[model samples]
Target: MTLPRIAIDAMGGDEGVRTIVAGVALARRRHEGLRFILFGDEAQIQDALGHHPNLSRAAEIVHTDRVVAATDKPSQAIRQSRGSSMGLAIQAVKNGDAMAAVSAGNTGALMAMAKLALRTLPGIDRPALAAFLPTLGDNDVVMLDLGANTECDARNLVQFAIMGAAYARVVLDLETPRVRLLNIGTEELKGTDEIRDAAAFLRTASGLPLRFDGFIEGDRIGSGDADVIVSEGFAGNIALKTAEGTARFVTDVLRRAFTSSLRSKAGFLLSKPALHLLKVHLDPNNHNGAVFLGLNGMVVKSHGGADEKGIANAVHVAARLVEADLAARIAGDMARVGPILSEEMIAK
Candidate 1:
């Protein structure tokens, strides 16, 4: 088996070079064939990796003098920080020097950099971010457009559904993943005019192999009614944050209840395993990264505050995506779906 070469932005995130270097070392241990190209100032990366003997021989560093600040605007960063670590890392993937790129920088900056470098697929209008959510059911659910493009048209939603379905099939190993358009209500007449029109397009569309389950209510996201959920970036981002907040609130409440009294503390000891399981299921760190779908190459966006373990998981996700040939599978699925709207329109 050929080893997957991953380009990582070592200057990204709050923890800076230290956590990024630690994450790379961790991932390298778990995945023997994984080769990494760390993009950042050579001195900083060397300083961080000096403590880890294993990483010295396992990874290579690609030096970049510039760095994109978290506060920098996406467009501005892409333009001004052309030589930044994040930008150069993405460029490596675009130039075929690396199979995938992982970054823990500003979400907008990462998205803009990737768009400018890798570009979207042949028929994709705009690429979107796809994040995994743990459902109440046995299988995990995929939610998309996680603040990639704030606005989307009916055709864009349809494209998201198709791309999302293909992603679930390849990544989640679902044969006939059920896809649903995220909406306030399940009724066809509900939501904006664009959504109604998009729903109609999906209904009459042909050759999209997966099961289209129509509109899904926001409340049913954790209910596991569908394997894949599609929505515009603005709405998807709100939904993802809301779920995270709810999970945190629930955990806090449980913690308070478990420590209120001596008896409660004793009971909590007995329930520690169950609580650990719940925390694992709801923790954002466990699902810290989102994939930039519809791009020609695999790009993963890690949380800006990601720690060593979180960054490691993001790299793991990127490695799996490359191994699974996710981008090629998505392109094949789009080709099979054909063009619902004008080919020229989407290409533009």
Candidate 2:
């Protein structure tokens, strides 16, 4: 199958042109059909392209020395976006120059530009930052609203559930993903008014392609009980950071325990293979894409510190979503239950 072209913000990440070029080169090697349009400094992009003849042939560069700084606020960056690599790349999506855009730049800036350029899909109040989280189940869980909007009402939470479930179906290949709201407790009376209202709305809705599994506590996030977890930006961001911190803590503790004594060192050697597997599973690079769902066009956010492997994974995610027509899937699901959701929200 022919894949859609992706526009790359070549000067956005920590290593800028070098990292983006190297990652695109690696991705093209694995998927020869992948195409890219690079936006950055002409000389630097050309210099990096010299190392990968295949990518040089597949990519087209649009030179611009301008870049969005790591410290630039979203509001400030959006005004200067016309000349920056991040801005131009997102514009390519809006202009149909590329089907999707990818960047490892300032997360706030990228989100701001994409939302402004691409706008939100019909029935979507705001876009949510969604990503896959490693779980103990057969597949990873999809979590949403990770720092996009600090505060959200019942309507936003319900919309997040619809968008998150659509994302899970495309990425995880689940037909009817089980979804739950992140809350203080699992009981019916657990969370705040917004959470309960959203849950109540979802339960009464008849036509969405998701299974409403009620509330899921923060501790149960990694248990794989729900395919999609929804929360307001404030709580979602905290839950995401806590999970990441816990992963690092476990790995650090294991490392220290394995080196405490000669006997422990020997034990570590005996369990080398198992430990290696665990390390790979916990590596953030292996799961590097965070998508801005509810957008009219596709935009993927790669980790700013990601290496070639991480960048490649992010590109792969963009490709998968484009191939699955995620926007249309989301729109269709919303249409199916739009009336029911509106009526329920009004009744409350």
lDDT of each: 0.88, 0.90
Per-residue lDDT, model 1, residue 153, is: 92
RMSD for all candidates, in order, please: 2.2, 1.4
Q: What is the lDDT, from 0 to 100, of the residue 162 in candidate 2?
A: 93
TM-scores for all candidates: the values are 0.95, 0.97
Tens-digit lDDT string for candidate 1 (17-42): 99999987887787777789999999
**Native-to-model Cα distance after best TM-score fit, residue 333 in candidate 1, in Å:** 1.2
* lDDT by residue (tens digit), candidate 2, 76-194: 99887678999999999999888889999999999888999999987888999999999999999999999989999999999999999999988899999999999998899988999
Error of 2 at 8 (Å): 0.6
Candidate 2 off by > 4 Å? 1-3
The list of candidate 1 runs beyond 4 A from truth reads 340-348
